[model samples]
Target: MKRLLVLSLSLLALCAAAALASAPASLLTPDLALERLQRGNERFVSGKMIHPNQDAFRRTTTAKEGQKPFATILGCADSRVPLEVVFDTGVGDLFVVRVAGNVTYFDQAGTIEYGAEHLGANLLVVLGHTRCGAVTAVVKGDHVEGNIPALVANIVPPVEKVKSENPGMDAAALTNKAIEANTWQSIEDLYKQSPIMREMVKAGKVKVVGAIYDVDSGKVNWLGEHPKQQELLALTGGAK
Candidate 1:
C-alpha cells in the first residue's frame, strides 16, 4: 500500500509539472478571447466553420504539453448546446464546464476556478440557451425526482425572480427571460462561492461575461458583463 501510494503521488506530481510547464506565459485578455468566440460562432451561423485546432498535430501537442485554453465556458448540458461546436472551438481551445441550467453550484464553481486560476483561461462565460429545459422546468415548477431536484434547485431562484418581476407574463416569455436571468445568477453565485474567482475578476485577471445561445439560429447573443457586476462584486468588497 505504501509503495502504491508513492507511485500515485509521483505520477500526480509529474502531471502537474507538465501542465505548469506547458502553460503560456501570456494568456489572451478577456476581450480578445470573447472576440474569438464571437467570430467562431459567426462562422458556425454562416455554415463556414473553419474548425480550428482539431488536427492530429494539434492533438499530439496538447496531449504532450497540456491544455492552454483561452476561454472557460459554463454552459448547459443540453444536447443541442454542444459548446465546442456552437463556438466552433476545437481541442485545447476551450475549457468547458457544463451542467444543467449552467448553474454555479459548488462543484461547478470549483471546476470554473480551476479553469481560470490553474489553466490560465482569462475569459469566463456563463452561457444560457434558448429553449433550455432546465430553466423551463423550473419556470413550470416541474416535480423532478432522484438527484435531479438538487440540480434544478440552483435554477429556482432566478426563475422565481423573473416570474415575480414579470407578473402575468405568459409561460414562453417567462421562460425566455428567466434563461437570461439564470445566466447572470450563475455569475453571482460564482462570485459568492469562490473568492478566487472574485479576486481574479477584481484584479482584471479574468473577465466574467454572459450570453444566450439560440439553439435554432446557431448564433450566440453576447450580453457582455453582468449589468449589476459592481453590486455583485460588493459582496466580497471587490467593487471599485
Candidate 2:
C-alpha cells in the first residue's frame, strides 16, 4: 500500500512538470489560430483526424493545468453541431459558448470577451450550421409565448427579412439564408454591442468572424470579410 501511494505521487508530480513544459510559449496570432481551426476542420471533413488527445495521460494533464484555448467559438445549442468535433480540437483547444440561434446576448457577449481578454484567446468565431432548428423555428413562425419566446425572438427578424427578400424561395433555401444572416448578425452584435470586444478588435488583439458549418459535408465556410454595418442592419432590421 505504501509503495503504491509513493508511486502514484511520483507519477503525478512528473505529469505536472511535463504539462507545464508542453504549454504553448505564447498565444497564437489571430491568423494562425484561424488557420489551425481550418486545418482541423479539413481533417474532420476528410475523416482523417489524428485525435491526438484521446489518451488518459493527455486528459489527466489537461485537468492539472488550466486550458489555453486559442479560439472562442459561440456556436448553436444544436446537438448535431458540436464545436470541438467539427474543429477536430481536443479538450482544451476551444472555449465555447453555446445558445439557441448562436445569438449574442449581454451575458454571452461578456463571456466571450472574458475568454479573449483574460484567457489569451485571439479568435472569436460565431458558428452557425445548416438545418439549424432555431433558424427553422423562426422561419416557420413558431412562437413559445413565454421565456422561450425570448429565445426565438432573437432569430425572427433575420428570418423575416430573408423571407421578404426572397419571396419565391423554398423553406430549405429560406432556412439556409436565415442561418447565415443570424451568424453574421451575431458577429456584428459582438463587435458593436460590446465595448471590450470592440477594443480588442480595434487593437488587433482579437478577430471576430462568422462561419457556417455544413452538416452533410462537415465543412466550415468562413465568411471571408465582414459585411458593412448598414448591410448587416438591413438584413437583421436592427433586431434587438
Separate clash counts for every candidate: 0, 0
Q: Model 2 off-target regions past 4 Å?
A: 1-27, 229-240
Quality of model 2 by C-alpha lDDT: 0.79
Per-residue accuracy of model 2 over 1-240 as CA lDDT, tens digit each = 999999999788656433432335254688878877887788789886656455787688779987778889999998988888887777777899999889988778889988998888888889999989888888887756667788766677777788899999989988999999888778877665576766667678888788999988999999954677434324422213
lDDT of 1 by residue, 62-150 (tens): 89999888889999999998888998778888899989889988889889989999989999999999999989988988888999998
Per-prediction TM-score: 0.87, 0.82
Assess candidate 1 and give its TM-score to the true structure.
0.87
Which of the numbered candidates is closest to the native, going by highest TM-score? 1
For model 1, the superposed segments whose C-alpha errors exceed 4 Å read 1-27, 237-240
